[model samples]
Target: MVEYALMLAIIVGIGWLIYNQTQLSDKINSVFNNAGNLMNDAASKSAKPPTT
Candidate 1:
């Protein structure tokens, strides 16, 4: 009855939280990955000797 409904609601809320967290983590990972790649490219370019 009411208990069943409560349990269902709880389960749904937990599932939503997990789904949201996963999406957020994926976005964070991509941002950091892009930043790391950009930094690496800059570093490599700077290490080379200047050309006339």
Candidate 2:
């Protein structure tokens, strides 16, 4: 009985870790996407020819 309980606890812990890591990965991806967009916008603006 105790062994079964221990196994269950380990499974739960692994599932929790996986869930948290997935959430963190999504947040990190969003941050990088935003940064890329900002960089692209800046590059586009700088590419325009200067006007008097």
RMSD of 1: 7.1
List the candidate 1 regions with Cα displacement exceeding 4 Å: 1-22
Q: 1-52 in candidate 2: lDDT tens per residue?
A: 9999999999999988987978977888999999999999999999999998
TM-score of each: 0.58, 0.57
| Deviation (Å) of 9 in candidate 2 | 16
**lDDT, residue 36, candidate 2:** 100
Model 1 Cα lDDT, one tens digit per residue, 2-46: 999999999999988997978977888999999999999999999
Q: Which whole-number lDDT from 0 to 100 does residue 27 have in model 1? A: 86
Where does candidate 2 have its weakest 10-residue lDDT segment? 19-28
